[model samples]
Target: MYRESLKKSLYDKEAVIDVHTHVGMSPRFFRQYGYPYALSVEDLVIRMDMLGIDYAVTFPFVDSAFYVNNTGSSKIETTTEYCNFPFELENRNMLNEVNEIFPEHAHKILPFLMFDPSRETEKQADFMEEISEKYPVFGIKTASTYIQAFVNDVEGKGRPILEFARRKNLPIIFHSSVHPEDPWASATDIVDLAERNPDVRICIAHSARFLEPVLQKADGLKNCFVDFSAFIIHCKLAVQNSPGIAIEDFRFRADYSDPLSVMVKLAQTYPDTMLWGSDTPFNYWIQKYYTGDGKLVEDRLECGYREETEILHALPEALKAKVAYKNNLRFLFGQDI
Candidate 1:
């Protein structure tokens, strides 16, 4: 529906900004799960134009080396040699791709430096600082789970990065999860980080995997924002796994079965804190699995850009404007769109 509407110029192209998107390759995902390894600048820009989006906040993919040790796999030995400092090469490549290849459209592609928490904080900060000086680094992007670190390990891993962001006045967007087993980037930890450092702006990715606590905390924290990338898929998972949780948590009367309506309600309630994101290429590809007989089966869970755009279009005009782009402008630059 959005695809057709966008083609008809029903939406404002200049009013949409995707806050969560990735470029470059992830060797582990490609090898292990048969996911697409590459998303070039041209590829993303074409998709953005088709969906009537004007800008995108992007970073490189989490390197394969970070997952090899945790996944008990030795297939990426060659990749591991270069990926010791995760996202180092990928970030550089992204900077070069946007700045060199697509210089005309560089301003439209807001690039964030990927911060690796497992490495020495000072070293990582030093590299980020050096790169910022060379390129247009808008903000910082990091995933604690990808690096096998906890988001609230402030003293050990998170504090130095927060300090760096504060010093530079850069917003940090984290990859989060609500799954109990993977507590690395839970909403509780993310909220703790936000509470401790009120000066630094922080965005909880994927709406903290659509958890209730994130929405509650974000409503109160001025510096805390939430991006609903992959909202359709994650919200459904949230509702199916825990029925009536949305109604119980937010005290709303909407049916949890319909994630889109719930999303509109959430955005209306927290207009200032909600931001839009598509997660892009990731939302397009489905994970492949192996059967007992060694046959590869594709699980086509297809709630992607089309569905995400539809959700944005479904919102009331005033709320849609904020979630689509205005909120991200404030979150990233402390300004209006």
Candidate 2:
């Protein structure tokens, strides 16, 4: 058996799934959206394969403006940013490329198309509907950075996007965590959406780091999902936000409150409300701690995509199975994986 197959036999019987990730970067948004240093899809996939992640979601890092709206007028504004610092690609192209390269696992590699309403909301929505119909997509990627901060739609920026996906019965993934200085949607925004539209499935990316109280409060939202991506494993931005907390603090509870432990606690408490995700390539923790040699020795056993399956492997088989895949399976597929 291959490494992943063997690992599956040993610990996980169900196919592993990572619901959060960004496979490709736009050269167009490098300056604005990408980190000074970032990983590529080739690098990310190899790492995940080594770590035993069967499949991952490829989220595209797009400029917020373009993601919200893609109209002719918006295109003109977006073109100005393309001189050198901007990099963008069509969703169809990215999906087709991946499908061609990995046909068998292509369906496992879900792509949530990006959109910007200020420019091409209708066009992007149309494209999203087409992609969902043609290819199996978990949902659409919506950034609070553009809709909330730039557009100043504190109330409705993501509403339309979520509504658009709702019609297709797809989910909307939101970047709920706070960046260094950028202000975007908060947990409250997600809460409002969930309360307003119970039918829309929303995944809060990065578990809305440092906002556990807020997220816990929003647990009543039925279609809400949380992607435990890049929160616990030594993310520089997260460290910057909460200074004086060393990475070592996360491995042991006696030292301090580890974010990963907190996330695991949330998962254990509300198993059906969240899914495991690596947030590949762009997010440092997914590639380093989970895949590469880092502080999360336990996470290393997971290969790359940190999930409850790997976390509860040593427990009784029945409970282990529930944590491993059953909970997330219910949320993702509405039944099982």
Candidate 3:
């Protein structure tokens, strides 16, 4: 048998599913939304095949105005979130492109609606709820980090989406920036919403960069999950964020307080609430661009799905299976297979 086939057999036949990834995105453009990258199913499958990634949750990019609002205020310095960014209907249609690609592949590809509202307009959320009916999405992607940082709500920003998740049994993966006070999307903000909306399954992407902020509190919340897709890059960022420190000073440590070690422990801490993801080209590409290296895409665009996945080798087999795919299947499909 092939390597992946042997691994599948070893695991009692559970498929490896990546919970977060974008097929394509327009990093920059003059006309608002830029062009999506090469996100054809073939392109995705090629990468997934290399990593033995069986299924992926794919979505499109939504142009966002994150740091400041339309009202000339800094959300970072403000306590109350102000929904002042302007979004257009035209920008939300990347779902259509994703739908066009994944449907043919059957279980191999799954599509999620990326609905990030720019302002406190119930209409945008309402509009996506109406438009979502026209598409086939297994779940939804809400924003806190990579997208808009609007406060979670029921009428403005992601308000309309709450209804969709409530009605459709849809699991929502949030773009999180929870710890140390991310005005855009924080764990406190997400947990508050998750607590209120008990019916919806919420997965905090990257588990707030795999720190204790999100995981430390998930034991009490049955529907809250944590995904660690971009662990290495986040580790790299931790180093870069502390440039003046020596190389040896750049360590998450190898103890219980260490982020990676915490990931392993959380398997036993909140086993049912942990999952794995590969933010894919989106995470890799955006990091390159934001770090002022997008022009060197060839070097930086190297995929890290494997780096993210192999790190889980430290987990027990059962826990690895749970995070790799079982938890995702249970959360998204309500099936253990």
Alpha-carbon lDDT, every model: 0.71, 0.50, 0.57
What does candidate 2's lDDT look like per residue over 14-97, in tens digits? 755667777555433353332423444566567667766765667666443233233222212344342211122446555766
Q: CA lDDT of 116 in candidate 1?
A: 64
Residue pairs clashing, model 3? 178-186, 178-187
Span of 10 residues, lowest total lDDT, candidate 3 = 288-297
lDDT of 3: 0.57
Give model 3's TM-score versus the native structure: 0.71
Candidate 1 deviation (Cα RMSD): 6.7
Per-residue lDDT value at 248 in model 2: 36
Please give, for residues 84-155, the per-residue lDDT of candidate 3 as tens digits. Answer: 322332234445544454445534666676655444445555655665566555777765443434546433
Candidates sorted on TM-score, descending: 1, 3, 2
Q: Tell me which residue pairs clash in candidate 1.
A: none
Give the TM-score of each candidate: 0.84, 0.68, 0.71
| lDDT, candidate 1, 1-337, per-residue tens | 3223332232334468899999888765676665656789989898888887888899887554434432442222223466546566777889999989988767568888787665556666777778877876778988666555667664476467667778878888888766544546676688777877788888998776556666778779988998887767666555565421233454334455787787787787788998999888767555543322334445444575677877778778888888876788778866555
Candidate whose TM-score is highest = 1
